[model samples]
Structures are given as C-alpha cells and as structure tokens.
Target: MRRLAFAILGLFLAAQGQAQSIVPAPPQVAAEAFILVDAATGFVIASEKPDAALPPASLTKLMTSYVLANEIAEGRLSRDEQVVVSENSWSQNPVFNGSSLMWIEPGKDVTIGELERGIVIASGNDATVAVAEHIAGSEEAFAELMNQHAERLGLSNSHFMNSHGLPDPNHYTTARDLAKLSAAIIREFPEHYARYKELDYTYNDIKQYNRNKLLREDPSVDGLKTGYTSEAGYGLVASAKRGDMRLISVVLGTSSPTARKNETRSLLNYGFRFYETARLLDAGEELEKPRVWKGQVDYAPVGVLDEIVLTLPRGKRQQVEQRVALVDDIEAPLAVGDSVGTLTLLLDGELLYQGPVVALEAVAPGGFFARLWDIILMWLASLFGG
Candidate 1:
C-alpha cells in the first residue's frame, strides 16, 4: 500500500460563506403516508408514515409495468409482438364499476408497446392483464413475477397479488417502497420511462388522459404513475428532474387524485429548496500517482472504482471535507483494481461516507538490482521505524 493517494487529509473549504439556516420543516400533507427522496443519492429528504403498509391501489401497476419492460429489455419479449386479450382481463375493464381501461376487446390482438403505453398512461387494467397473460400465461403467475421484482428491488414492505392494482388486502406497498421502486424504474429504463410522460393515450378510439396531473402543472415533472381505488383512496409515485438533480415523491392514501398530486408537489418543492445533490468524483479518475517499490513502473495510479455523489442540506456543502488513507509503501506485482486505500468523506467534520480506493493500473516486479535496492530500503526503513 503506497501512502500515495487515498488519504482523508484536507480541510477543503470552498464556496461562499453562506450562513447555515434550519431547513424549513416538512409540510403537513393530506396523505396518510408519503415520502420524498433524492434520486441520485437515494437520500430520504422527508417522510411521514412512509413505511406504513397500505393498499397500493393502482400503484401496483408500477411493478407490473416494470416487469414487462424488463422482459423487453432482456430480449425475452418484444414490444411489437402481438398478445391476445383474454376474457378475464376484459372483465376487469371499464364495462364494470368504472375501471380504467384501454377498452381492449376479449380475444383481440394488441402489441406489447401499445399495452405498455396503456398501462403507464391510461392505467388500463385490461391492457395490464393482457400483457400479464402474454408474459406469464395467467394473472396469478404474473403477480409472482411482480413479487420477484419487488424482492429484487429490496422492497421489504411491499407485496403484490395482481397485475393491475385492484384492491386486495394482500396486495399493498408503502410510500417509501413505492418511491424506491419508481426510482429503480426511472434509473434502470430511461427509454421505457418516457412513456409515463404521455399526456393522453388512445386505444380503440377511446382517449384517456394520463392520471398523473403534475406533468400538466409542473414543467419539471416528467414521469411516474398515479393510483386510486375506493379502499386505497389516491396514491402517486412521481419523479421530477431539475438540472442534474432528480427527486422522487410518493403520496399514499390521499382523499383524491388532486390531493396526491398536491402533496407530491409540496414534497418535491421542499426537497429542491432545502437540499442539493452534487457529484463529487467520477469512477476511475486518477487521484494520485505514487512511487512503488521494486516495480517495473516507478509509480502506480490509484482512484475510486465507483462515482461519488452527495446530498446535503442546502448551503451546508461548503463545510464538507475529504481525506485519503493509504499504506506506507506500495510493493511490486500489484494488480489493477486491487484495493489500495480508503477515501473518507465528511460534512462539517461528521463522517458521511467511506469507500475503497483501488489501483488504476497494474505494477509488475522490477529488475533484480531494483528489487535488491528496494529490499535494502525496506529493511532500512523498518530499522528507522518507518
């Protein structure tokens, strides 16, 4: 370990000396449960009963859409492939009890791309079941896939019982879990995520506007989905990006769709006003080149293997510090990506993050004379208690 690069050392005080003020308290919301998080850093900015298990209502479709999109992404399914609308899926349509639907007819054929738009934009239960049936052969099987995706996403507080978010006591998700799921979908599938921005979707000559109202009212709000049922009230998982920072807001159990949108907007506003996310470093950017003992190359370059991003209270970023800690002397025959040191990050002297620093390139053993010289130097250094 060459004591060359990853050392937490400096008091890097930069930026204007802006006074630190208490961030305004999070707003009281009408929703029973809600959360707001920084998408880039996954830092929760605000929450109220975020983990409370409650009916996901239509929000359940978020996972359904995610699973279907993933299948396409993995090349197991194609967007243009035709799928048949089964009688079971159509029965869950608007013909009964005002269910949101794309009005897909039973036994009719439709493309996966159209159903994707229908599920995301129109909240079409029929389309959802059709896609589910096409993918897994039954809604029950599709729900199992949904659960697998939820588990993979680490949504411990969530479970799915259906493809479309019809009300079921067994099918529920929390605000925090929904936020995480939404963030995953947005970050993992940018191309498919764009479908959420469509204001209206038309199928079977019936056009329904997207249920997420934030898109119309806020220019920064680009995507996500909305959900509502008599039992679930109204729920929404919304995401908005301004500049380089994106925020995810989940509001569950609002009295109405408008309430969900309003609460989500409030949370987004608070996060944007009170916090800032910054990219601190890029992966593999050489931070230091330090001397290596008995190596073919006289030095080895070291840096982080992953990008570093931080979300901090607004105006408090100037107080952040960073230092690197590395070994006293590096030896030859070091492999690329071998752990070399550690980089510790702190804000206002409080440790916030620590990550491994690794060698950016390999170092081979040196010639015999050089090795001997290094050996002698090492022995001498040990005698001096170095």
Candidate 2:
C-alpha cells in the first residue's frame, strides 16, 4: 500500500510569528474519579482513574432512563402512553422513605413521559419503579434489559441491579462508563434528554427541582443528572456546549453537593480552556479514488463513513495533518462500505480521528477478459516491484 500525506485545508491555522500559548497543565479536581470528553469525537481530554467501578447512587437512573429511551425509540412505548402505577411503586412505600420520590399514586393516570420527567428531574425512585414495572414486568427484569444496553453501549464496567439506583453491592459503574452513557442520551434521545434541564417539575401538586445544580449555574449546561447516597457520595454528570464544541464532564465520589458541582465545573472549565473541537471532514466528501483490480470499474470511490471530528490542544489545531494509506492492488468485488484505506488525523502524538476509509460505491467483478488483463498487469507491476 502507498500512503499520502497532506494538510487539512480551510480549518483554523496559526499565522506565522503569532503569539505562542502553551496549554496549561490540567487542573487538579477533588473527586474519586472524573473525566472530560468532547461529545462529538468522544475524545478524553482529561481523566483520573475514570475506570474505577464504584457505587453510582441515582446516577444509575441514567441507565434506567436509557432503557426507557430505547423502548420509545423502537416503538414499543410512547411518551404519552399511560402506565398504571402499582402498589409497590407508590410514593409512600417504606422501602423509599428517605430517597427521592415523584409522589406517584397507584393509578392509571400517569404516562411513561411523566415518569421520565420524574426520574430525571425529580430523581424519583417511585417514578423509576413505575416505568420499570410497566416496561419489564419488574425491576429485576428491567435490570437485565439495562445490562443488555450497557453491553451494547460498551459500558464495560457498569452493571445494573435495580431501576432506582438506591444502592446495592453489585450495582456500580465507572466515571468513564457514565460519561459514555450521558453522551449517548444527549445524542440519541434528545426528546427525553430535554427532560433533564427542567429546573422544577410538578406532580400531584408537589413541586420538585432538578438535582443537577449546574443546569441552573451554567447557561451553557443544559441537561444531565446528579446523585447522592451515603455510600456513593455526591456525583454529577454534566454536558455543556460552547461555540462549536460540546463536552461531557463526570465527577463521582465527591464530598458534597457543592463539591460535586464545583469539581464538575472545574473539569469543564479546564477542558474548554485547554482544548478545541472541529470537524475535519464531512461524510461522503471524497478523499480518494483508487484503482480497483478485477472489477467492472477500474476505480472505487473512498471516503469516511461519518463526519470526522477532532479535539486538540489550543493553538495546535493548525498543525494537524491528514494521511490516507491506500490499498495498492485492491481486488474486487468490493462492497459499498468496504474499507478502502486507513485515514488518520495527526497533531503531535494525538490523532484525534482514526477511522476506516470506506468505498463510497460498490465495484462488481469484471468480465473474464478484463479480469485476465488486470491480473497480467498486476503481475507485471509486481515483477518490476511497482
């Protein structure tokens, strides 16, 4: 295979003799585990022990909401469809004495959508159970579905034991895993995700405010969740967008509500202050057209499967480079999405984007004489070390 290197045009480029600014060291954050990731590229701008599995408190409700989101997405449930609250999920259940509850009464008046708001904005354990029972027959069965989603989303260290996330020895997740889940919720289910930003929600004439204080403190911050349990400590997952960049910050096992909020804000500030994100290439913007041997067409179109985005240190975006290593004698029939080459975007040691360069169009096998001639040509090229 032969490789081609070129500068990415039209992106921000540093001018000659411009004022030099080195990215400052990441700020120290007070938390057991924390991470800041660029939402579009899922790049870890900074992290500390982000994979340590620990109790997630109500953060586990994020997964419960995720499962509910999936049910809605797949047409199994609708937001407005009513779910009858069971006696077990009543607000006054003794099992939920000190935890959050949405004041749900055992009745048919509640909807899946209402419970989504209760679960997210109110952090209501009763609401979580209602939705869980309505979807999976019981919380235990619902947890199995949550694990299925955890497996699908590549939440390697996260497991769900219940829908409410009260506390259990086996119920734990990593900071990194929660960040991934938060990003997915924002990206995949905006309708449901919008529930997280509501400062206050009312059910049964009781008003409850969202526990995620960042939603009120930072205008850029929109929707996410907060958690607190004696065993889990205070935790928060926040997502904020500034200009072209959106970031997800996770701070877990902090000392207090104020500590979680401050630590999260600190992480977000550090990431935004030090890094920048931009799209390097649009999907289907042809990057290469390489020769296709033994095919009806002599060439195959090659490009990215999706748009290429990158998060880089401040001022270093200008120095980034693009490289495509093309297949030298790509034999086909080639499928539309078959890998044609490997594309890399590099700035210093970090290649914020590294993904398959795929065939934009398919190539069917050539007729007998065309194949034979191409084979002979390939042989001659090999003989001369071409």
Model 1 residue 138 CA deviation (Å) reads 0.6
TM per candidate: 0.93, 0.88
Question: Which 10 residues in a row give candidate 1 its minimum summed lDDT?
Answer: 1-10
RMSD for all candidates, in order, please.
2.5, 2.8
lDDT of 2 by residue, 233-348 (tens): 99999999998889999999999999999988988988888888977788887887888899999877888878877777777766777878876778889888898778887775
What TM-score does candidate 1 reach?
0.93
lDDT of each: 0.85, 0.88
Residue-level lDDT tens digits of model 1 in 191-301: 999999999988888889998989999999998998888899988898999877899999888898778888889889999988889777787877788778999988888
Candidate 1: where is the Cα deviation over 4 Å? 1-11, 14-18, 91-96
